[model samples]
Structure formats: C-alpha cells, structure tokens
Target chain A: MENLLEVKNLCKKYIGFELKNINFSIPKGMIIGLIGENGAGKTTTIKAMLNIINKDEGEVKIFDLDLHQNEKQIKQDIAVVLDDSFLSEYLNPKSINKIMKNFYPSWDEKLYLKYLEKFNLPINKISKEFSNGMKMKLKIATALSHKPKLLILDEPTSGLDPVARNDILDIFQEFIEDGEHSILLSSHITSDLEHIADYIIFINNGEIIFKKSKDELIENFGIVRCDEKDFKSFKKNDYIKYKKNKYEYDVLVENKADFKRKYSISVIDKPTIEDIMLIYIKGEK
Target chain B: MAALKGLIIKDFQTIKSYKTTILFMIVLFTIGGFLNDDIITFIPVTMPLCFEMLAMSGFSFDNLSNSDTYIRTLPVNKKDIVKARYIYILLFTLFGSLFGLICTILVQLLKTKNIGTEILISDLSITSGAFVGIMFVQIFQIPIMYKFGAEKGRIIQLVMIIVLMLGISLATTAIMKIWGISLDNLAVMLKDYLIAVLGIMVILLYILSFVISRRIYERKEI
Candidate 1:
C-alpha cells in the first residue's frame, strides 16, 4: 500500500476537550512528525490508533487493513514508545529483553544487546533509576529490537539534551534508510522535527491546522515584518495570520514568492516550524 | 501464546524483585511454628498468603509502570492479558500449596512425638482449604483489579467481600428452601461427593471470573 497508516474522521470527546474530524496518513519510507502543545490531543490520537483507548468515532486503517478486524496481525509490524508508559519499572534491560522475546517473532537478541551497548545502558540496572535521556534510549532500544516496519513514538525527545536528541534523531534517520520503514513521532519539540521529518502534522486545540511537506513549509511559507503603515496598506487576504509587536507587525504568508510579488516589502524572514506554530496560536487571523 | 509468555515472564520478574522479603517472611513463620505448638497452623497459611501476594503484586507493578498501555501497543490483546494473569495466579497457588504442605509436615514431625490420624486429616483439609481460598480470592480480586486498577481495587475488594458473603448466605437459604432439605440433612447426604462438587464449582467460578475480567478490561481505557 502507498500509505502505511491512515486515519479518517477520528473523533474523541472528553469532558471539556474533543478531537474533531481528525484525519492524516503516513506514506511508506517517510517521517511524519505530530507537532502540538501539551493536551492538544496528540497522545490521545496515538492511543486511539493503537486501540489503547476506545475512540468515540473513527476508522483507522493500518497496512490497508481495518484496525479493529485485524489488530494482532497489524500490531506485529508496529512498535510504539510512549513518553510516560512502558513495561514495569521494576524490570531491568535484561529482564525486558527476556519478556520482549516472547512478544515478537522477529525479536533480535543480538540487535537488542548491540543497542544496549551503543546506548551505554546497563543491562541489570532497573529502568526507574535511569535518567530521562537514558530511559528514552532504553525505550528506543526496545522498540527497535523488534524490527517493526512502523515506529510510533510519543514525545520521545521531550526533556532530552541536545546531544541525546541528536543521537535519537540519527537513529531514526537510519531507520528509514531501507525505504520500507516509517515513523510517526509526536513531540512539542519542533526543531527536532525540522531536522528529519518529511511531513509535519500540526495540531492545535485538538484540531489539525495543516499537514504540509517540510520543504513546502520552509521554502514557500514566509513571515513579513513591517511597520503599522505597511501592514495596514496590505490587504487582509494576503496573510494567513498576523501578530502585532511593539514596533512592528509580523505577518505569516503561505507563499513567500507570491507575497513578495504582491507587496514591495523587502524584509521576509524565514520561518521555522516553531515560528509558524507560534503565529498560528498567538496571532490573529 | 507468545504474548502470554511475555506477560508471564514480566510477572516473574516482578515476583523475583521481592525475593528477600518473601524468603524472610517464610523463614520467620517456619521458625515461629517450630518454637510454639499453637503457631503451627498459621505457618502453612503463610505459604498461600505469600504466593497470593506475589500474584497480586504483578498488578501493582503494572500500575506503577502503566504497563497495560504498553501492552496494548504490543501484539497482545486484552483477552490474552487476562488469561495470562489467571494462569500466573493459579501456577503460584499450586506451588505455594505444595511448599506449605511440605513445610507443615516437616515442622510437625520436628515438633511433636506422635501424629494422630484425625489431626493429620484435619491438617491436610485446612491446607487444601487455604489454597481454595486463594483461588476464590483471585476470582474476586482479578475482575476488580481489571476494572478499578490495583490501588483502588483493594478498597473495592473489601466491599465486594462483604456483599459476596451476604449473597452466599441468602443464596444458601433460598437453595435449601427450594430443595426442601435442611442444612444437617444436606451435609450428611452430600458428604461422600462434597470434594468433587466443590472442585467443579471452583473450576466454573474461575471460568466465569475470567470472562468477567476480560470484558471489563476490553472496554477499559488505558
């Protein structure tokens, strides 16, 4: 199948929050980053896709098969690492290996040991004693040992140091090298996604704002910084969202080329994923 | 099957962490029984208690780690997880009963000079009863754990026990009235087949409890 995973009209409602008409798809051999703030329904979407929680309404298809009908077979090819959930904390890496062996038919002991060594994780030390970075590495190691075709990680890089984050990014980069693997990693850390993600699925307040290619976001999208007069002179339809600053207004444009062609403004700063997200959240339409 | 094996191994690892505490308690109780004749009965009771704790502690560890969410991410389904839990509890119960029986006999031989036949039979019955109690405990405890979680389940279990006791009494009286048999007459009439009947009830209860626990877990939002 062209798309490794697809979600359609996914809806989940809590007391005060709801994920409305959520939809996205992950094509093969690509990294799709789920970027959203805390309580933005990123984790909830992941949980629903994996059957961890009962979604109010939705249809999830993995490997072109219905998720509810062929769950076990579908799960054999998917691995996940949740930010705050894992196997028992009382177990060490060695014990985790023993337990994982029985769950996956393709579990590779050699690869697991290699990851433990590469990550500098002690075999016998309980996971509860590991630092946040170490714990993330251990989780990543376990997730990789199964050699799954798809890896879903929820905030795996949160609270991690830059060096550790780079190491994890490097591993994810290597993971998709074979052109058969895909990754759906959700994180508030947009900078990391900027480095490796091919597609960015931005969610705000449980609603998807956009799902655009990273190249399109970095190349076509631009921010126009101008004085009040220049901002007022421009038509409202030219900009997507605008934020008023002390001395200037920063306007987010969908097409830098079209924006530059329309306005005579010279200053069009490049926008990062975070800057785009900030404009969407903090700026007015 | 492999998923179930993985779950069982996870529980074994959790049980292993309590090694020092388990051994210490068992040894302490055994020594206490050897020193005092009155304490003998309670020593075997410790065996069933220890293993029951071992089985239940797995749920506590799972709660602390939020492993149920992790398990859902794996190839395991809710039914297999519940089945694995039941199997783990029963395996430990069997082992615990054997250990308790051996230790009780050894302690009895070491402490007293002559063992009366009647006392021996009653002692054996008590040991068997304790293991049966362990099974019944799981039948009640597993579904509660699956529904409310390991922490809140303890309080719920207490409430369930009281309700269950009241239910059993009312059920027994109703049953006697419907059959037109007094308690004394029924006991005398069923004495020969009491063990077999009880065994069947135990098996049926476990099956029914497993179904209930699985249903509760399948709908639970981890």
Candidate 2:
C-alpha cells in the first residue's frame, strides 16, 4: 500500500528538551494513532510536519512530495486540527464562514453551516462563548469542510466529554470512508484510539519506541501474570515491561505465544496502548 | 489570486468584527475634524494620523495574539501570509486616505472655499504621508513582531514611531529654514518622491520582513 505521509529521521531540539531521530509513516486510508506521554514530542512532530517548527534534521514527505518544496500544494490536500482554538474568539461563525470561504478552494459553505447546526452551535455567538467541546467541534468542522485528503489531528479530543469525543471520532470515520482519505491522529487517550486506529506509533521521552499495526501490536504483546518468584526468573529482554506486587506480577512480553510455551505462566489479557506505553516507558528508565 | 482574495475577505471580516471600535474612531475623527475651526487645514493632517493609527491597529490584530496561528495552519505558505498582511495594510491605508480626502472635501465645501491647487497639493501630501507612515510601520513592525511578539513589539513600535515623528519634524524645520521650503513644497515633493522611493522601499521592506518572519516562525516552537 502507498504511504500517504512519510516522516524520516525527524529531529528537533529545544533548550531543555530534544526529539531524537524519529521515523514513521501512515498508509493511505489508514487511521494511525500517535500514542505518547504528555511531553513525548507528539506536538513537536506534528509542528515539524506542518512546517510550523523547522526541523533540525530529517525530511517529511506527503503525497510523495517533499514537504517544504511542495508546501503549498501539500497543504491544499491536508487539514489540521490543533489542540487549541486558533480561530479569533471575538468573531462569530458567520464571520469565520466568510473568511474561510476565501481561504479554502473547496470550502463548502452549505456543509459548514450544516456542521454548525449538527454541533448545536449558535451561529451568532462569538467563538469565545463556545464551550471546549463546541470549539473542538468547530475546529473539526472547519478542517473537514475543505474536503482535504489527509487529516492531521493533535490531541483533538483531549478535554472533550465521551459523547463529544465519540461524535468527533465518528466524524473522522466518516471522513475516511472515501477510501482515499487518511488521518494521523495524536492523542493520549489510548482507549479512544483503540477503537479507530488501524496503526499505532508509540513514543516516549522523545523517542519512538514502537510503530506497528494495531492487530500486530495486540497479537505480539500479551499480559502474562505470574508469581513474583516466576517473574524474577524471566530475563528482562524476554518481556518489554512488567509490574510487580508482593505476591503477583503482570509482565508484558514481546511474543506472548513463545513466552507462554517457555514459562508456566497464565496469560491474563491483551495489553492496551496505554498499558503497553506505561510499562515500556517505566521499563526503559 | 484566490489566496489574496481570501486574505482580503479575512481582513474585512476582522474589521467588521471590531465594528464598534471602528465606528467609534470614525465618528470621533469626523466630529473632531468638524469642531476645529481650521477644519480644512486640520483635516489633511489629522486624517492621515487617524489612518496610521487604524493601520497599526489592524497590523496588531495580525500579530501572534489574534490569527497568526490559524492562518499559518491553513494550506497557506509564509509568503502568502506576509503578502496578505502587506496588502491588507495597503488597502486599509488607501481606504483611510479616501476617507481623509472626503472629509477635506466636505470641510472645503462647507467653508465655501474653492478646491484650489493648494488644497489639492496638501491633500495629496497627506495621503502620501499616510502611505509612507503605513509602509514604515509595516517594514519595521512586522520584523519586530516576528522577533518579539505583539506584547513586547508594541512598546518597540511606539518608540520607533516617536523617533520617526521627531526625525520628520526636525528634518522639516531644517529644510524650511535652509531651502525656504514650506509645508506645501514639502508635501508636493513627497507626493512626487513617495511614488518612486516609497514604493521601492515598501517592496524591499516587505521582502525582508517576509524572509525574516518566515525564518523566525519556522524556528518557533509553536
């Protein structure tokens, strides 16, 4: 399958923080979750891809074109929903609609108004008066109204309630239903991602720990719970991460089927993205 | 260009958003122009000043605080953003100049004074001066905003404006004393000089500002 977006050896540095060499890609028609901790360079990566922040080293290619060289064309096909409402808070939706109509070539006024109605947002109220969920929905509505081929969301559902979050996710699903559309969604809410993400990229402390398909990730990593003494006997390399109590231990193995045959341990469950991340991040340190 | 059109619409929307403030300023300037007995002469001077202030306010809105992030996030390039801002300022300044001219005409018509060559020259001068000031602000303020952001840039912009006004005042006094050049002569000279020199300067400053802003924005963590 062709990759919709490719980021190779992406690197950026700040005074106190640094994003080490990172590489990942999203296939066309796939919804990839960029899973990471609070400061795991998720925003940094998205910013670099959008050229909001310059990269120290590495390259980003979208639609097989170099990001910087073909930035204008690349951007035409892409939509981004940032964590915050970047729209002018003093302006109402009517004003924004007028402004956006001029900016996006494919801006659908009817569709935008439809979304405004669907989201139950008052068209006359200024954006500042919007609730957090309403603002997020607005952002999503604006981003999607342009008929963009790729959607890049950075923590778009962070502060939203479950219903609103699900509504947004449903919108995303509808967006990619065309089969040519793709999405790169960055979120800390692993459960949300678990339902929709086709592929997962796990990051921690500015480094990419793993990038794989969700099914593969689930199939490969399993939660093996056993006695404390049994956990002590297993080598660290055999399992990616593990948690221990006084008498019981829950370990995350890279290859659960192989580990299961070797050790007399009960495989408790499949690990979620959050569980995997917590274990791996702690284990790495 | 569609992109340019988009920017114009966006700027107009922004102006519309601050309708109350704009209306207040317009009425205030209009009334202030009328109340002065020397309304005809004062209109030329005060109108440009008001225009400069309005242009500055518009530029201020384009700073980091208002819509920079959202504009940047769109499928628009840094060059588009820079060009849009410069164009917005130019258009607004033109609007301001037209408004000033209309006010002058109103005052002249009211006073029953003929729209003579001297009045024409003065009006032209005021328009040119406003253009120069707007260009100067664009050239200086855009770069400062790229480096310092809106909050700190405002202070720097104020200092720069004060210095510029003082320099212009000193230059005018010196020229008048040495060359026997009055305000009308200077205005006429500016009307001629601005078209060539100011245009080139504006273009150069715009290019420079665009390059610098793009670099700074690219490097910015946000």
Candidate 3:
C-alpha cells in the first residue's frame, strides 16, 4: 500500500534529552494517531516533520518527495495546526479573512465564512477575546479552508470540552472520507485516538516504542489478571509489561488466546492504548 | 508576491495598533520644532527623527512579542519574514520623509522666507536624515535582534549606536585636525559623496541584515 507520509530514522539530540532513531509511516486515507506521554517528544517529532525544528539526522518524505528538497511543493498540500493559534490575537475574523485571502493560493473565502457561521463564531471579535475552543475552531477552519490533501495536527483536541472535541473530530473524519486526504494527529488523549485512529504509533523518550494497526494490537495483546502465585508460574518472555500487587498480578500477554488456553490465570480483558502505554512506560522503568 | 503582500498587511496592522503613539509623537515633534526654532530650523529634520524611533520600536515589538511565534507558523518562509521587515522599514521611512517635507513646506510658507531656497534645503535635509537614520537603525538593530531577541536587543542596540556615534565624532575630529580642514570645509568636500556612497552603504547593509537574519531564523527551533 502506498503511504501518505514516511519517516525514516528520524533523530534529534539535545543536552539532556534525545529523540533516538524513530520511524513510522501513515498509509493514504488513514488517520494515524501519534501517542506519547507529556515529555515523550510528540511535539518534537511533529516539528521535525514540518521542518519547524532541525533534526540532527533522518529523512522525512511526504507525498513521496524529500521534505527538505521539495518543502514548498509538499507544504502546498499539507496543512498544520499547532497547539496555539498562529493568527494575530488582536485581529478579528474579518481582518483574518483579508489577511488569509492574500496568503493562500487556494484559500476559500466562501468556505471560511461557512465555517464561521457553522461554528457560530463572532465575525467582529478579536481572536484574543475568543474562548480556547473558539480559537481552536478558527484555527481548524483556516487550516481546512485551503483544500489541503494532508493535515498535520499537534494536540488539536487539547483544552477542548468533550462536545467540542467530538465536533472537531467529526470534521477530521469528514475531511478524510474522500480517500484522497490523510491526517497525522498527535495527542496524548489515547481514548480519542482509540476511537478514530486506523493506525497507532506510540513514542517514548523520542523513540517509537510500537507502530502497528489498532486491530492487530487489540488482537495480539490481552490483559491477564491473576493471583500472585499464578503470575509467578508464567514465563517472563510471555508478558511484555506486568505489575504485581499484594493480592493480584496484572500482566499483558502478546498472545491472548494461546496464553488463556495454556495458563490457569484469568485472561479477563483486552488491552487498551492507555493500559499498554502505562505498562510499557512505568513497567519498563 | 502574495506572501509579501500578506506580510506587508501584517506589518501595517501592527503599526495601526500603535496609532495613538504615532500621533502623539508627530504632534510632540511638530511642537518641539516650533519652540526650538533656532536649533530645529525646520520640521524635516525633527519629524524624520521622531518617526525613525517609531519604526525602530515597531520592529522591536514585532521581534519580541508572541507575534514572532505566530508569524513563524504561517506559510511564509524565514527569508520572506526578513525581507518583509526590511520592506516595512522602507515604507515607514518614506512615509516619514514625505510627512517631514510637507511640514517643511508649511513652515516655509508661514515664515514668509525664501520659499525656493528653503524648499530645496528642506527636501535635502529630510531625505538625507531619513535615509541615514533609517539605515543606521536597520544595520545596527537587525544584527542585534538576530543574536538576541527584541527585548534584550533594544538595550544592546542603544549602547552600540552611542558607541558608533562617538567613534564617528572622534574620527571626524582627528581628520579635521590633521588635514587643517574646518567643519564647513569638510561638509563641502563630503556633500557630493553623501548621496551615492551612503545610499550604496544602506542597500548593502540592508541586504547583509537580511542574510544574517535568515541564517539566525533558520537555526532557531521555534
């Protein structure tokens, strides 16, 4: 299958923190979720892809073109919405319309107006006076109005109420419905990703811990809970990350069906993105 | 370019936000010129100086505030950002020079002086003063801004300008003493060279500032 975005051996280094060699790809028409903890290099990875921050070493290709060599052309099809609104806070939507009209070659004034009406955003209010949700909506509206083929959003759902977040996610779903559009959504909200992401890429300490299809992850990993004695009887290699308490032990197994048949312990539940992340991050340390 | 137009609009909007300050300075300078008639002589020199400070402050604000982060996230490149800043400086300098010329004409009409001679002097003074001051600020501030952001750059820029002015004064004094040339004689000798030489220097400095700013911006993480 052709990929919409491909990152190979991405590396970035700082004094104390290092984004070790990382790799991932998003297939065309798929919504890929980039999940990581607070300081797990989610923002840095997105920045590297956008060329907003320099990478010590690696290659990023979008639409099958080298990112640096064909940056302008690649960016023509790519839209980015960082955590903050990039629009001038003192300017209102009317003023922003005038400014954005001049900036994007494919900017749709009609679509922008439509979004403003749909979102019920005040046309004359300065962006600074906008609520956090309103500002995020405006940013998303501007990003989508340009007819981009690929959308790269970093924590776009952050600081948003559940209703607002769902509304935004619905827009993203609509954007990719045509099979010509793709998205790389980076967020720490694993539940949201679990609901929408076709593929999941988990990162930690600037490294890709796991990249796989959600179905495969769900099918392969199962949460096994049992008495401490039963957990002690299982081999170490069978479990990826496990926790032991006074009375019970909770463990994750790669092969749920086989493990349940062979082991006497109760393999009670499917592993979630959050459960997987918690075990992988805390258990490994 | 469309990007250039967007940047220009952004800069104009920023300036518009500071309208009250610009108006206050213009009125203050006009009054100062009238009160200190002997020293100011005309509004050409006075108005341009005041506007130069405004332009510098505008650029400083653009560099230091949250605006820098906003602008960087746009579709515009770092090189374009640097180019747009220089364009903004040119536009404001021209506006200031034109305003100064109009003020000079009004002052000449009010004084009932030699209108022809006064017009020529006022035009020359305004043009030269705006050009030199604008160039001086751009060349000095751009480097400082690139190295340190606007907040700290403003302080360093003031110190650097003061040092440069003093150095120029001492050098000119030494040249006059060695050559046995009076101030008036030196002015006469340099008058013709000022337009061509200083104009070239300003253009070169502007380009140099752009190159340096681009390099610094490209390396910046944000």
Best by TM-score: 1
* Pairs of residues at least 3 apart in sequence or in different chains that clash in candidate 3: none
Candidate 3 C-alpha error for residue B161, in Å: 1.7
Give the poorly placed runs of model 1, Cα more than 4 Å off: B112-121, B166-187
lDDT of each: 0.89, 0.79, 0.79
User: Please, what are the lDDT tens digits per residue for candidate 1 over residues A122-182?
Assistant: 9999988999899999999999998999999999998789998999999999999988999
Q: What is the Cα-based lDDT of residue A190 in candidate 1?
A: 94
Query: What docking class should model 3 receive?
Result: acceptable
lDDT of 3 at A96: 77
Clashing pairs in 2: none
RMSD of each: 2.2, 3.5, 2.7
Worst 10 residues of 3 chain A by lDDT: A82-91
DockQ result, candidate 2: 0.47
Per model, the share of native interface contacts recovered reads: 0.91, 0.56, 0.32
Instruction: Estimate, for each residue in B36-94, the C-alpha lDDT of model 2 and write its tens digit.
Output: 75665555556556655565565556653346666767777777766676677667767
The superposed Cα distance between candidate 3 and the true structure at residue B167, in angstroms, equals 2.4
In what order do the candidates fall by DockQ, top score first? 1, 2, 3
In candidate 3 the C-alpha lDDT for residue B206 amounts to 76
- The alpha-carbon lDDT assigned to residue B92 of candidate 2 equals 72
| Model 3 lDDT tens row, B119-188 | 5775676667666766767787776776787778879988988898899899989989998999999789
lDDT of 2 at B30: 67
